[model samples]
Every structure is written in structure tokens, then in C-alpha cells.
Target: MARPVTNAAFEALLKAAGYGNAHAAFARQLNHAGRGHGTWRYDAASVYWWLRGRRPAEHVQATMTDVIGRKLGRPVAAAELGFTIAQVPATISYPTSAGHAFGAAEQLWAMLAKQLTPASSETFQSDVALQAALAWRYDLPDETVSRSRRQPVTAGDIQSLYALADHFTNLDRRHGGGSPRARALMADFLVRQLAPMLHGTYTDAVGRELMRAAATLSGQFAFMSYDAGDHRIAQHHLTIALRLAKAADDRLYGAHLLANLATQAVYLGHAQEATRLAEAAIDGAGRVPAGVRARLYTTAASAYGRLGEGRACQSALAKAERALDRATPDAGPRWVNYFSPAHFAGTALKCLSDLHLYRRALRHAPDAITLAGQNARTRALHTALIATTHARAGDIDTACGWGRELARHVADVHSARVNHRVRELTAALTPHQAMPQVNELLLALAATPPPE
Candidate 1:
């Protein structure tokens, strides 16, 4: 008998569907989806056999794909899972027209509303992301955003949307982007309110402002999705936001969105792609406000840090500092207000820490904490950074002290990024578990429930 070939593509798709080695769970999902078909009692062993080259019935394959598609917030085909059939592309392209762009945004919003779990198997696609960035950089701006259908959109409508965006921004800053209440409210706002307005008639000037406001809200949701650990959804929203920015002819904001994408890429371990996106943002954003320029530099610094390019990272950081020095309090868009001295210091700390320069990273800890203002999520993250720095520097006692402080705030913030940092701190301290303080910190973290 011939040796059976493993279904590698199917295996990869299963993992990407958030079922990492959870064969039993995948089986259960299939069973649940196939409730009307028969009394299917698939288990881990069954999944094992399937992955090893045994093909399931056609109905079973359909059920499996359907389950995976829902979890991924997009469609999946049998061929994409390695079945012998006509191949279907399971990819989303960047929208090239306003009608398509709005449709894409609406589709994403609907999917987000239906998602039950935050887990996703969607990995960052550098080619797709870079292509979008390049398009934003070189695409011709839309000359007019005017529409001649539905009710006329007014400047008052734009102002109202901006005000709503501001409200959501404050909520995200204070409670973290993973806050369930904030996410729910923002989703409703986008779907019920913003979608209709986007379809309404408007003049060229109002249409431009409308697109800018829509881009702002979409970008906010993108950041929230990233913070919530939904990388694929975040990328989708960001692509839409970048397209909207282009439609509005706001190159600076488009650059900002690219920088945001770079930040996400670095977080998801795509450091090379991140570096390229960050560079694209800087090169394309001509004569932006000082704060925006500073932000772009810091974003590049982060990507370089992740790549271990110390000289390039430092150069970017230096440029960021200089640009930040020239930033006036009211110089840039309202969004740029978040890029203050404290924010710059925090970015520097992360960059230095990524290079294993723990002592240098610790130098910025105080400023990060004191100047973090009322942003609970930022404070928690900075605390985790400080704790991890100390632990990596062999200062277990001090690291434990900071870990204890972090434990106190763990229940308050709802950010996956903050939780990730806590996990990093725990990993750094795990080696010294023999010590009482380290043991206590670990126990506390183990007991800490994820934010609701």
C-alpha cells in the first residue's frame, strides 16, 4: 500500500481557524454545524484520521468549511482546504471604487457583529498589505465625492460623526479597546448610523469631509480590533480606512493609517513588512504637521527595533524626537494630540527594550507612568514593560513588585495587548519560580480572569 499524503493545506486552514491542535474542538464544531445531517459524533481521533489523508463525505466537508468560514469572518471553499476541487480564492482585495468601498465596510461591520469569539487564524499577508500601501501612496485622488442620491448630507452631519468618533476615542483610551461596552456601542454606531450617511447625497466639499470622518471612525475600529486581537478584521478595516483617506485626498491621514498598519504588522511578528510600511508612510506624507511627522518616525523606529536594526532604530527615534520638539499643542489634527512627550517616551522605551537594552528602557519608565494621564490601558502596558525590563535584567525582586502592581490593574483594563504584556512578564519571571515573590506573581496572574 502507498503511504498517504497528509492534507497540509487543510491542516493549515484548521489552525488559522483558531483550532491550534484542538482536533477535538474542531470535531465538535463540525458536529454542531452538521446537526440536521445525522448523529455525527466526530472526535479528536476522527480529526486525526482526516488530517492524515482520509477524506470525509461531501456533506461533512461542506459543514467543516461553513464552520471555519464563520469563525474566520469570511468565506472558505473546499479547495482552499486542500480538497480535490476547483480552487477558489479566499482573499479580500482593497476596494478601488467608492461603492465597493462602502460595501466592504458594511460587510466587515456585519461580520464583526456576528463574531462570538475573538480568536482568529488570520495571519498578516504582507503582499496584500504592501500593495494597499503602495496604492495609497501613488493612486490618483478622487476629484469629487459628491453623490446625487438619498437625503443630502450636510456639514452638521459630518460634525455629529466627528463628535461620535471623539466619544469612542475617549472610551478606548480610558477603558482599553477591548472593552465590550465600547465595542458594542461603536459597532452599532457604524452599522445603524454611519452606513446610511455614507450613502446620502452630498456636495464635493461636504463629501470630502464625510469621507475623512468615516476614515477616522474606521481607523478607530481598526485599532480596537487589533487591540482585541482580531488581526484579520483589523487589516480589513484599515484597508477601508486607507481607501477612504484617499477618496478624501488626505495624504497625511493616509500616511497615519499606513503607520498604524505598520504598528499592527510589528505586533503580529511581520517586522520586515512593518519596516517597509513605515518607510512608505514617511516617504509619502509630505509636509505633514510636526506631531504627525513625529508619529510616523516613531512608528518606523518600532519596526526597526523589532528587526534588531539598532542603528536604524536609533536614527528613526532621533528624527521622531526632533519632530516632536517642533510640535505645538494645537498644531495637528485632533488625533495627533495623543502623540505627546509621554507617548514619545513610551515608544522609545519599547524600541530600546526590543533591542535587549533593558537598563535604557527602564530610564523611561517613570515618565511613561506619570505622564500616561488617565489612560488606564497605557498605564498598565507601561507597567508591564517596566516589569518585563527588570525581569530580563535579572532584577526579579523589583520585577515582582511591578508585577504585583500590574495584577491590581489587570481587572480594570480590557486590552489583549495589555494581557499579552502581562504574559511576557510572567514568562520572564517563570525561570525564577523558586523565589516566593516570583511564585506569588505567577499565581496571581494565573488566577486573573480575562476582562469581560
Candidate 2:
């Protein structure tokens, strides 16, 4: 075999961080940073391997960057340590101008719809998401989104975009984000109809409204991509949505996008980055509406739970509950409509489940199920959560019963996220396969088809 390439940059950074070839010292810092999550147990040997170009997992790399940055009293990006991130397409980069951003978004939609390249197998990178959040938080607001073109846009045209956004949102809620009809319809509308409208002439006020509408549509596409397991595509679309929100000068909406990114991070197991993004949204959102505040805090609680910080997790959950109590049903923006009591309970169940508070988690199940209303995806996920909690609590028969219910729900939905939860349930119950009901549930789950 050929020799592994050396990571000279990483070695140099280690010295700059005052480790000075003391690999064990650096490893100790990493272990400290990763304490609550699980065992890092890294030693000099691990650092030596990394320097010899055995790249660590994405989450470990993120932790390494954090440890080194703290040591050197500066921000250290993954790139600075000789880690190569997957190249982001040019169209996915931060926007330089209103027209440029719109054009880039159009091209991105085409790329996503056409599948010009194979989907990436790489996991989500926390650093990339964090950097995008920071950019949105600090970047100067656009002076004007006004543009002159052959076609002129009107207020009525902007309203139509909003209507289309609502239509797509409803379709996604009913059919799930992995629905082929929803994906195709959204792509077609964005490319053939919305793209030209974005390029059309409009006043500054109209332009901002248009950008806001675009942001909403882009966010919907992001969630759809996420549900279909196209994580890289989801991150790209989410970043674009954040930029559009910035261009519209809507700080609360920008915070909302950051919260979404945090949720994605937590789903992908990047607990540290999720916490940072959630806190950034909460801190930067100067006196947000109660619903928005509740969402951000709930996101933080989920991240904290993932990290096994039960105390911090419970504190955040309490804050979210208080904020929810203060929120009126129709008070916040259109996006905040999703942050109802049922939705809050669902997230709380997830946080509590992660911390192994299984009984507490199950107590929220009824509210989550009954109040989920018409959202098939939410109902399926919460069902899976309930089943998984039972399995983890050593109640195989009860777990199997819930598993059968999940199997029924899974059959009707086409979501990778729901499928993933089913897989987790399967893993938890596999050892109980001697039981007939558990075996039957496993067979059912095994036969479930991949989402289109």
C-alpha cells in the first residue's frame, strides 16, 4: 500500500496551539471537550494517526477545531487544520448582489431537479452550517433589492408567490416532504415561474417582499431535501434561504432559518454545533415574538439532550414552555404557526427520550399524537418515538405493539426521517426477535420501500 500523506498544516497548528508535538496533551483537550457526549479516549496515538492523514469523523473534527481554537485564543476553521470539505457549488456561495443571488438560486434549483451529479454520501458538516449562521448574523443588510428588467413585477405578482408558497407547504404537510409530486411541482414552479419573476423590475418594497416569499419557498425545498435524505442539498438550499432572509432585512425570519439549521444539526448528531446555532438564534433575535422564542429554546433543549446534558436540557425546555404559555395562537409570523403546544410537546418528548427519561417522554405522546392534526409526517415520527422509548425501557411486548402502529404509519408516509426512526426502532428491538410480534415488526420494517 502507498504511504499515507502527512497533514503538515495540522501538525503546525498543534504546535501553534502550544502542544508542540505533545500529542497526548492535545488529545486530553479533545477528550475534555467531548466529555458529556461519550468517550473520546483519544491519546497520543490518535493524534499521531490524524497527523499522518487518517481524518477523524466530522463531529470529532469539529471538536478538534474547537479545542485548538480555545488553546490559541482564536477561531480555527477545519480548513486551517488541513481538512478538506466537499466543494460547495458556485451557485451555493454567499450572494454578492440581488440579481446575482436570484440567478444563483435559479441555477441551484435546476441542479437539484436535474441531479447533474450523484448525491453526496458525506454527513452534514457543523462548521459549514455555523459559518453560514455567523455570516447571516453579521453581514450588512442589503440597501435595496430593486432591479430593472424587461418584465416588471407588481404587488399582485408577489402575493401570488405567497399563495404558491402556502400551496407547497400544505402539500408537504399532508403528503410528507419525500412526496414526488410535491418535489416536482415545487421545482417546476421555482425554475419556470418564480425565477423570471425574481429577475423582473420592482420597487425596493416589492423586491423585499419577493425575497421574503422566495426565502419561504427555498426553506420548504430545504426541508423536503432533508426529508428525502439529501442532506448536502438540504444544507445548500437552507443557506440560500438564510441569505434571502438577510436580503429582506427580516431579522426574526433569519433567526427562524437558523433554528431550522440547528434542528438539522441535532438530527445529524452534531450536538455542539446545534447548541451554538440555537443559542445564536436566541441571542441575535432581539425580543422576538413568544412563539419564535419558544421554538429557539426548544431547539436548544433538543441539542442539550443529545449531548447528555440533562440539567441544561431541562432548563431550556422549561424556558420553551414558559414562552409557549405567553404566545397567542395567531401572534407571530406565518412560519411560527407550526410552534403550537402539540409541536412543542413532540420536541420535548424527543429531548426527554434522548436523556433516557422514557416514562416522561411517553407521557407527552398523547398530546403529540392528538394535536398533530393533519400532519402525517409529525404523527409518524411521534409514533416511532413512542415505540422506541418503550423498547429502550425494556418493555418488549409494549414496544412491539407500538412498532406495529409505526409500521402502519410508515406504510403511508414517504419520509427518510420517519424511515430513519423506524430503523432505530428495529435496532432496539432486534435482540427481542425471539418474540413473534417483534419478529413480525422487523419483517414489516425490512420490506418498507425507500422513498422516491
Q: What's each prediction's TM-score?
A: 0.79, 0.78
Winning candidate number (TM-score) = 1
Q: On residues 165-252, what C-alpha lDDT tens digit does candidate 1 reach at each position?
A: 9888888877788765677667656755676577667899999999999999999998888887877777888999999999998888
- Please identify model 2 stretches exceeding 4 Å from their true place: 1-92, 116-119, 449-452
Q: Encode model 2's per-residue lDDT on 212-255: one tens digit a residue.
A: 98999999888887877767777888888888998888888889
Clashes of 2: 0
How high is the lDDT of residue 40 in model 2? 43
Lowest lDDT sum, 10 consecutive residues, model 2, at: 111-120
Candidate whose lDDT is highest = 1
Alpha-carbon shift of residue 81 in model 2 (angstroms): 43
